[model samples]
Target: MADLLVRGGTVVDGTGAPPTPADVRIRGGVIVEVGPGLAPAGGAERVVEAGGAYVAPGFIEAHTHVDGAMWWNPDLDPLPAYGTTTVVFGNCGMSVAPLRESARGPVLDLFCFLEDLPLSAFQDKVPWTWERWPEYRRAVEGQAVSVNVAGFVGHLTLRTTVMGAEASWGRAATGEEIAEMAALLDESLTHGAIGLSTNVFDKDRYLKPVPTRLAEDAEFEALADVLARHPGATLQLITRFNEPDNIDADVERFARICKPRGIRAQWTAIPSTVREDYLREQTIALHRRLRADGVDFWPNVPHKPLEPFFNFERALTFQRVAAWNHWINGPAETKLATLADPQWRARAREDWDNRVSSSTSRLDRPESLILAISETGHGPLGISLKEYADREGLHISDALATWIGHNGILSCLRGIPDAFDEPVVAGLFAEPHTLTNINDSGAHLQLFCGSGENVYLLTRYVRDTGLLSVEQAVHNLTGKLAGFFGLGDRGVIAPGLAGDLVVFALDEIEVRPEEKRYDNPDGSWRFTRGPAGVRATIVRGVPTVLDAEPTGERPGTMVGLVSPPN
Candidate 1:
């Protein structure tokens, strides 16, 4: 890498301290100096004028599901431009490694269902050459990407690898199988895995519990034991706050198992919207109890609301609604047939009416659902579903079906966002035992755009609302995340640290609107956005994105607690 000098900027330093005017110098991917009036070494250094910009450590995407997408979408577009330099993958109990040859199809199905990715995209794009976590890491290290990547070993992947493809879903693991899984997890952690991620709160499109939910207590104990041996490793538990029937028991189980073992744990997430006030209170109480009990646990609160766009072609958005679930997961021929069937419409209307009150889906509030994107320049593109229903003189369920028949099956629907409870949101951001910005970026590419939502913390919370200071926001995005993940080498603009930095004026950046991009390997389209107007995004002294455009440099490599960013 070339030696670079960034001059004429206010340094945030990623420590939550006040900004200071300084010059930062980098040599061979490491920060050599960070102070005022630093001069370039002879004429061999490249100078970047950071006039009127705040130079800060590059942002870290704390939780993501980019395990499968990283292979196909190596550039990780829109993130580098949004000032994100590091990404953690293999979240929500899904990783792309340690697979059995016979379980590949089943694993792909699970990933696609959970992440809302197309099965064809995974089949056509990912190389799938590695079977173990270490081998997966090696393969990833060889690839060129713009953002540094780390991941957790998935419990579902481990179960499927040891137990047969059929047995992993239907029964608890045998004692021998649990031992094999523990050994594999130990080996993964010994190599470079950040931790173990398991899910207990989700169901597939078929409304069946995910495979990780079938894991027994013995399996969890063994996994927690492995994490105990590996210092700084975390136990990420994915829980369902919306359908929180077993939430209390699930959290108690996680704490009871991991806390005694001295393993750090994090769950996704606490509710942040007014509609979920009850859930938010319940979660806060749970968090307080966990902390009182001397547990090292963090509840993840998303900085952005979960405003999802739905389409019939491929989406799990309607999984909670039984009739819609059948239509969504059915074959192409069955999709049109069911939509036109009177019996299906009746069932769908009944299901929409009888949906549980705790359901967060827009099905409960179809009036807030809009007919957003059209596939073929069709009429009635931008209207509420209720308005359309009124105009067509039909029930809401029948109206949606009729609209889809008139328009194409590929058209999309979107839900209007609810206002965030600002005080609660601010509290979550300020709390020490909370993880903010848990955007599931790189997953749910088709259903929603999670890529640039991190910028909302900077744009809305810091600048617009004044809920958080610039220093605090920068610290949460950088230093706090680094400390939590045990990444000691980066996330701060200090001497001897990696030169991963983002430089931009506060007024210059804004999260762009979502647009359709047809760049998938399978010739499919996905929702994407433009940059947030970052002047420069440097990864390890190399400019991955400069002046609002990608420099096409792939300086990022596998990042872990033990392995520094390469």
Candidate 2:
């Protein structure tokens, strides 16, 4: 690798300190110097002139699901352009390792269903050459990727591997099963896994709770005990954020399991939305109480609002609604037949009226649903579903069925997102124990574009609304996440640190509009956004993205937790 010099930029060292004018020099994928008036070494050197730009440590994607996607799409498109140099995957109990041949299909099925990922792509694209964590790590490290990758050992993967896939979902593990799971977790942590991630928040297309939900208190205790033995290992849980009533009990249970074991526990989030202020207050109070008691539990928060696109081809968004879930999980012929079936339509209306939660699915609110995409160009696009129903003199559910039937099933209905709450976001941004930037990028590819969502933190919060200063925003994106994940080597712009950095003028970057891309292995399409106009996104001294385009360079390596809090 050639030596590199980044010049003429205001350096924000990612320590929440004020920005200062400086130049950074790198050699052998490590920062060698940080000062102004730095000249290139006598050897070969590449220079990036970052005039009038902010130079900061490369942004870390704190939460993502690129574990399976990385196998086929190694470039991790648009992430490089958004200044993301590191990505953390294996989240929400969806890692793709430690599986037996019998568990492979079940593991992939659960991952695809819950994540809204294409099942065909996962079945065909990923090279499942390993059945253990160490082998999985070697397979990933051998691949050339655009960003550094770290991951956790998924609880679902572990359960399915030890206790047959069918039994894993049916009942709580036996004592022997729990012991086997603990042994596997210990082996994974000893190998390189950052920690363990489990889910209590999801149901599959069949409305069945995930296998992790079957885990008992003894199971959790066993896993926590294993994590306690490993220094710098953490425990991650995805709780029921949608069901606000159960959140307090979930937090208390998790604290009991991991807090006593002396392991840091990171949960999916603390609700922060304009529509859910009451629930947000409850969660905030819960977190405060945990802090007062000195519990090492950190809650994550998403900086972007929830904007989802619903489609029938393959989606879990309607799993909460019985009528829709049944129709969506059926075969193609069954789907078309049931959409026109009068009995089915009646049941759908009943489900819409009584079963669906307004906070989750927007099926009840046709007015806020836009007919965004048309797979067959059957006409009538870009109109709200309510308008279509009004013009056609049809019920809302009937109108939706007619639209999807007329246009191809691949057509999508886009929901208007909740309003972004500036004050709530600002408070969480400044909160010491809160983990920001929980963008589920890599998963839900067709549902929403998570690629450029991180740009909103810099664009909306810092530049537009002034909710956060640039220093604070950068620190939250870089240093804070690195520390939480125990990645001691990178996430800062200083000598001896890994050469991971981004450069761009704040005014030049904005979250780009989402567009469709037909790049899936099965010739299917997915939603993806374009660049955020970042001048450069360098990973380990190599410029993966330069001048807003990919450089076709793959310098990423398999990174692991270096110093996780005990």
Off by over 4 Å in 2: 356-358, 376-383, 387-393, 564-566
Task: Report the C-alpha lDDT of model 1 over 1-566, residue by residue, as the tens digit.
Answer: 56899999999998888999999999998899999998878777878889899999999998888777777888888789889899998888888777877888888898988788778878877877788888888888998898899888888888888897789888998899999999999999888898999998888777888888898888899989999998889988987667778678888888989878988889867888897888888888999999999999988887787677888887777777789887877787777777888888999989877766655777778788989877777759778998999999998878998888778788888889887797788777787778876888887877778888777888888899899988888888888888778787888899888889999887999988888899877788887888889899999888888988888888899988752434
* CA lDDT of each prediction against the hidden true structure: 0.84, 0.86
Measured by TM-score, how close is model 1 to the native structure? 0.96
lDDT per residue (tens digit) for residues 61-158 in model 2: 98899997887789988789899999999999878878878898888888988887878887888888888888988999999999999998999999
Q: Whole-model lDDT for model 1 versus the true structure?
A: 0.84
> What is the alpha-carbon RMSD of candidate 1 to the true structure?
2.1
- For model 1, where is the 10-residue window of minimal lDDT? 557-566
Against the true structure, candidate 2 has what lDDT?
0.86
